[model samples]
Every structure is written in C-alpha cells, then in structure tokens.
Target: MHDVVVAGAGPVGLFVACELALSGCSVLVLERDRDPRPPLKALPLGLRGLNAGSAETFYRRGLLEATMQASGAEAQEVGADPEAVEAPGPRALSHFAGMTLNAADVDTAALPYRLPSPAMEGFMTSLDAVTSVLTERASALGVEIVRDAPVTAVSQDDEGTVITAGGRQYRSRWLVGCDGGRSAVRRLAGFAFEGTEPLFTGYVAEVVLADPDQLPIGFHLTDSGMYLRTPFPGHLGLMDFDGGTFDRSQPLTREHLQAVLRRVSGVDVTLDEVRLASSFTDRAMQATTYRMGRVLLAGDAAHIHSPLGGQGLNLGVGDAMNLGWKLAATVRATAPDGLLDTYTTERHPVGAAVLDWSRAQVATMNPGPNAPALRKLVHDLMRTTDGTTQVYRQTSGLFAHYDLGDGSTLVGRSAPDFRFEDGTRLGDLLHNGRGVALDFTEGRALDGTAQRWAGRIAYAAGPVRNNLGFTALLIRPDGVVAWDAAHTPDRHAFERAAHQWFGAPSRLTTGAPSL
Candidate 1:
C-alpha cells in the first residue's frame, strides 16, 4: 500500500515528496536524518525559512530557473531595474538575498525571483543553490527517498495508513505529515499543536568578513536584544541575542560571534569560519487541526512561528504548495472531500496571521516599560510608506487571501496580474501544473465549466491587465482564488467554491461512477 507516505525529508518533507512524485503518487520518503548530507542541507536560513513558496512554488514549472542553474547558484546582476526587474513590479528587487527585511518597502514586482535578498536575511549561496535544485528535482520526480527512516509507530484507521520503521512496515493510502517542529505525524495524528514557546532563543551566524566594510548592509543593534547586520554574496551576516536558553554552556562563540560583530559593526572582523550555528525557540505552534481523516498536516506540521516575519520557511513552503495540489487531486480520485477541506480552510487564517505577527515582533523586541517607547513607535512605523507597506504585507508571502464566497470576484482578493492577449503573464500562464480560468470578457461560461473539469481545468481567458477588478478568476492547484465575480455570500456555502477550491467536484462514493 503506497500512494503517499511522506513523513519528513525536510524542505517541507522534500517538497511533499516532490509533489507526490509528480502527481502519479507512489511515494515513500521517510528520512529521520540519515547520511544524506551536503553543505548542511545546502545552507538555508535567515529572514525565516523557505522564502515563501520556494520561489513562487518552484516558479510555476521552470523549476525556479532550473533549480538555480542546477545549484551552482551564482547569478549576480543584483537588481536596479531589468525592465523594472522583470516587469510585474510590486515586489521583485533582491540584492542576492541581503537587503530585504522590509524590502525597501514592498512591491515585490511579482514575487518569485528566489534570491537577491531575504532568505531570512541573506547569504546562503542562493539558498544552497535553491535547495540543490529542489533535491535534484525531487530525485527526478520519482521520489522514493528513505534515509534512515526514523518513525516509531503511526497506525491509522479506515483501512490504510500504517508506518513503523526500525523494523519497517510502511503501508499507505494517505499520510503527509511533512514532519518537523517535533511532529511525529502531529503526534500520531491525535492532533493539537497549540502555541507559544520561546521565552527567547535565537543565536545564528555565518561569518566571513575582513573588510566587507565591516558590516552595514542592513544593520541593526539593540541594547541587549537585537543585533542583525546583513549582506551576503561573499559574506557578512550575523544575528545575535544569544541568551534566552542559549547555553551550549555559553555557546554562540567564535569568541561570542566576534564579540557581537565588534559590538554591532564598529568594525574589527575576523571570524571567517563558523559557517552555520542555530538555536531556535519561538514557536507559536498551530496544528490544533489540519485534517485528521487520512492523516494530513503540512510544513512544520501545519504551523510553528516566531522566525518573526520571515514567516518560517515561507509558512512551510506555503504548506507544501498548499498541500501538494490538494493531495494530488485527492490521490487522483479527482477531488471533493470539499477539496480536502479547503486545506484547513485556507491555511488556518494564514496561520493565525503569522501568530499575530510573531507576538507583535516579540513585543517590539522586548525590554519592557514601554520598550523604548515601543521601539520608537516601531522605528517610526517601519520607516513609513504605510509602515513599508505593512512590512511588505508581513514579509512578502503576499498576504495570502481567500474568502471564496459571493458571486466571487477573485474571492477575497490577491489574484491580479493578468495581461495576456498573447504576451503572457497571468503569472506566466498560471505557473505550471495549471488550472486557471479567469474569463472576464465573461463569454467563456467556464466552457461548460471547462468540459466539466476535464483533465482538471486549464482554460485561460482575456481582459483585466491590472485594472485590478474582477471579471472572472478561478485559479487553484494552490495558487488560491477558488472562484470569483467580485465576491459575496459564504456562510458555509457550497456549490462551486471554484470547483471546491480547485479539485473535488465530480464525485460519488457508492453509486460510484464519479472521477
């Protein structure tokens, strides 16, 4: 029995076992952290994990610039306007993963460049060459990946999911944990992840500066709390605050991170070694529920916060690309368990609004007694432009939206960027495992709902080149739109939440001719 096992190979359980072995689904992937080593899981860390949806969910299908030129990862033109940095203009300006905390104030052009800046604060050799081109394209998309198999028990009901592993049993019909954040499949699928851990525990490093101007790309230094310092194509990175529960017996030393990078960059640098060192603690947890039936839960096993607004590996690769095409269209039965229950109804209110913006950025970096007048009123509202577009709408995961109700005009918004009479760019024609249908001239009438969801809806239409209104906007397979007309009604509504959040409409069970 094997359709989807995927417990953990990290990087959201190896991209959800490379998207359930490219949706054919035979997948195994266990990994308790066996020999598979390389640049310590190819150097990924900083602004927060998995830079939101790992390069626009693998840049729709170019597999994020062919896995950063097959992980040799050395592309440095470093932004200034390559046609407003590749046209879509709103959030696309990276300086090799460095100067991008608030992103000079939002407008990621159109997201998904991967790196120039903000892989949780930069310098990870193009995020270990884009996670070694997504672990060599998830092992050429067949995805068996075992690696030491550290599961202990698992078991399931309704006849399928069993696991074990020190003896090896491994059966499966469904089970996706993406195990991390102490999740043993959300603790044997009993569920309840809850929140708040981290009295304070940070300490990170990656030094290599003799005179890289001794550090001053994005600099930050606090009395006893913060100490950031950015920029990293060659080197010059730091992230201090090594005393919360950080005691490898007073560890966090290369002489205490070169004396906190010479007391926050006054200069005096020499710690060229110490490639990586971690000590995290700031989980706001969340899996109170992500699904229990077939045993599902995703990335960081469905939420764990306090990497602050680096949104923890881009919210665990946006919950492993929104639970990998709704669990590969519900294991190809062709969707409808209310589209796998709208992936916990649109990612648990965006993981409780990123755990209330990482506990209000740790109570404005804690110090108490009006914490330096609330950190000078949040550094004058993150140095305004509406607090740098609300800190790039809380660290450029582009404020995940979805209410999916009403006549549905891009349901609860965030689906703009159409422009394709032929020039193309409905985000490069819905980025790959396609399923778009934004008509708008309003004449396609879903082409009979696209031949009643034939081969899972791919039909595209015209109009709305950033007029930013909605004529039509279907979009799913984890991009999120799930129907639109301008939106309205949804008090537990159901009919076509755009074919129930993009897969799972044509169903049946016993009368049985669905698919």
Candidate 2:
C-alpha cells in the first residue's frame, strides 16, 4: 500500500506528493486529465502571481532555481537590468481588486523582520511553467502519478483508506484531496464546505478581436459590470454582476462572450474568432475541517476563493507546504500527539482571511453608487506610503503569520532568510525538509538540545551580523520559526518547543527513524 494517495495532479497535489516523497513516504497521485499541457494553461490566460511566501516555499525545497531555469529565456526577458537603479516612487507589483499599489510608496524599513533573500516578493508566472516544474520534481522524487484517473469514492477504516478511481481501487495509509474546487474526494468524505455564493460570473477568454482599439488596455469599471483588456491581442477578461447565472458547465459560445464584453465595456467590441474560454466566480468556500479520519483535504479541496489579487494559487500552495511534512510524519509514526491537527488549526484562519480579502475587493469593485466613493477612498489611501505598504505586505503574503501564542516575536513567522558569516543561508539548510536550530552565539545549549532530535532537526552554529535581536532560532521544516531566543539561550524553553514540534527525544529513534 502506498503511504499516501493524492487526488489531482495540479500544482498543489504535485507539491504535496513531492514533500512526502522527499521524506521517504510512498506517494501516488491521481489526475482526472490525461494531458498535462493545455492551451488554457498558456500565458495571458494562465498567468499566476507568485508571492513571497509561495516563492520561499519553492526555494526552500531547492525547486525555485530549476523552475526558473525551465523558463530561463522568459526570465531573462523580465530580469531587472543590472545597470538600472530603481527610481524612488511606487512600483506596483500587483493589484487589489483593480486598484494597483506602487512599491516605491511602500516603506521596506517598516518590515523590520524581513531579511535579504533570493526570493522575490512578487512575480508573475504561467500556470503551465509552475505545473511543469512541480511535475518534474515530483517524478524525480519517486512519486507515482496516474492520469485520466478521477477519484470516485473514498472510504476509510481504522487501518487505512481505500480509494476508487477510474474503476480501480488503491489502498493508502492516508488520502488527500487536492482536486480543484469541485473535489470528488471532499464530497465523498462528507466535508462541510460553507461560504458565500458568487456575486458575478467572471470570464477569461482568448479571441480574435476585429476592433481591438475599441476597448481600453486596462481595467474599466463601467455602470453595468467590469472588464479588463490586456496588451496581448484578442485577450479579454469580463465580470458580469448577473448573480452568476451563466452556466459554466456548458461550452461558451463566441456570441455569448461578445455580448458580455459589449455590455460590460459599453463598447461594441467585435469578436471574430474565439480560441479558448473559461469562467470563474467569487464564490468563496472552505471546508470546516481539513482532516477526517485517514482522509484529508488540501488546496482547492480545502478552500477556494476568487482570483482577485491572485491569492488562490498561493494560498493553496501554502496549505500543501504546511500539510505535507506534518502528514508525512504522521504516516511514518514519528509525529507528536497533535501534530497533524495543527494543520487545520493554523491554515483555517489563513484561508478565511483570504476569502475576506476577496470579498472586500468585490465590495469596492461594485458599480453601486456607494462603491465609487469607497473606491475613491481606497485609491487615495493607496497613494500614501503607509497605505501602499500595508497593501504590499498583505497582497505579497509578507505579513502572514500564525498565532503561536506569545513567545518570541519570530515565533509563528516565516524564518528570515539569514545569511550567516560562513556564507551559508538559512534557506540552504532547509532544502532537506528538516527543522533547524541555528545558534549565532556559538552556544552549545541549543545545539545539544537539537541533537536529541538529530535526524529530524539540524543544528548549526554560525555568527551573523544582523541578529534581528535573536541569538538563536528554531525553524520548522516548512521554514516557520517555531521558537526563538533573544540575546541569551533558553535551554528549557527551546527544548520544550523542540518536543512540541519534533516529538520528545525518547520517542524518536537514531539515524532517521524508519516507517
């Protein structure tokens, strides 16, 4: 039996499978679609924004370089000019609703905890590139992927779970549903998904426009609805606030798309040929809980929201990163008593916040009379330094933190990618999918404690000029700071944290515990 059976082969599922395999768990991924490449996955239509947290997750796994390399030619085109110095002003990396915030207006000094790292705060990439990179990584890690296999049913007993897909049965110690928002596994597992319904039906389409100049080249908020036209010829996005009456299950016709575009933009935009079309809604929903017995949910299966701010992909990836190691430890019988449960507790709040963020954007985007004033206020605020900084931090996922309950300031925050005096970076140490106890004061107290959990936690001694007011830090496998000590080492406190996350020393075996 496989250790884990992952439903869906999207970026999230592939990522989770890679994480499990990296930790020596046997993983099998089932995907409903046979072809990995699709026209809709290309640029313009498949554009996805990668925030700092998401980029850091990929970088920590030693996957970012390869992923970027896969798109090397494109990267070079977008790469910053070595000789060009950025001017002082707002540099917009992304938008909230349709309102863009400039980076120059943001005060980086305000984010004291942020450190210099190779990961960019935000970058635009294609879904095809991300999926290709993740798929290659998963395959290299020994993950078995079966396509054209849609999970139909899932049942679990005390021993494990039995999954039926494509008329075949597979047994696994655990099952995870990463299949998109309409998750079959989640339905079969009886998860309680609750959230607001859609306010509008959004469309992304690539077509041949007879009169491109008729539509503006940016987002426009009209009386009837909203529409966006990109620099790319024939590409358009529209949102009709029709209470989501459009049937997404049916094939979109050229005539229907043209009608929606004309009505939304208040312009007669002619569509000659339709290449591809897809629809989405602002219907946000989240599973009440992420786990049920031996079956679990991640990615869109766990939570879903509108594509506003491009937070959906990043949020889903974060879920996979948080759940992967914890679930792997549980399957291998090395997890602490409540390790697996923490996944839901920590991620649920994050998901809820993203949903609310989407809702807030939709509120501001409404064509109602009150919306214009609200939008004006938001636009004016975004022009200020503090307002821009706040938006940047939130949209870039830099301000995301868990409530680890009053310890060090670093606790429950992403570990600052510290560069030690020895030229070793914290991210380099995390590539192995292990926790780290980094001591900058050359004290043996934290090292000795970390040694007790040898294979699970890596202990490093190094000196760094920027201490961020911390002498030592305990970083979790997912690069979250589990515990930290300021100025002096706290053996007792550090030991307790180590036990809480890595289990007590007495419970673990030497030389990487076996399953």
Q: What is the lDDT of residue 414 in candidate 2?
A: 88
TM, every model: 0.34, 0.94
- TM-score of model number 2: 0.94
How many clashes (backbone N, Cα, C below 3 Å) per candidate? 33, 5
Best candidate, TM-score: 2
User: Model 1 TM-score?
Assistant: 0.34
Model 2 misplaced regions, further than 4 Å: 72-91, 506-515
lDDT of 2 at 84: 27
Candidate 1, 342-421: lDDT as tens digits: 77887888878878887777766654466688777677766665666665556656456666554443455445445554
Q: What is the Cα-based lDDT of residue 346 in candidate 1?
A: 76
Please, what is the whole-model Cα lDDT of each candidate in the order they appear?
0.60, 0.83
lDDT of 2 by residue, 25-64 (tens): 9999999988897778778798777776787888899877
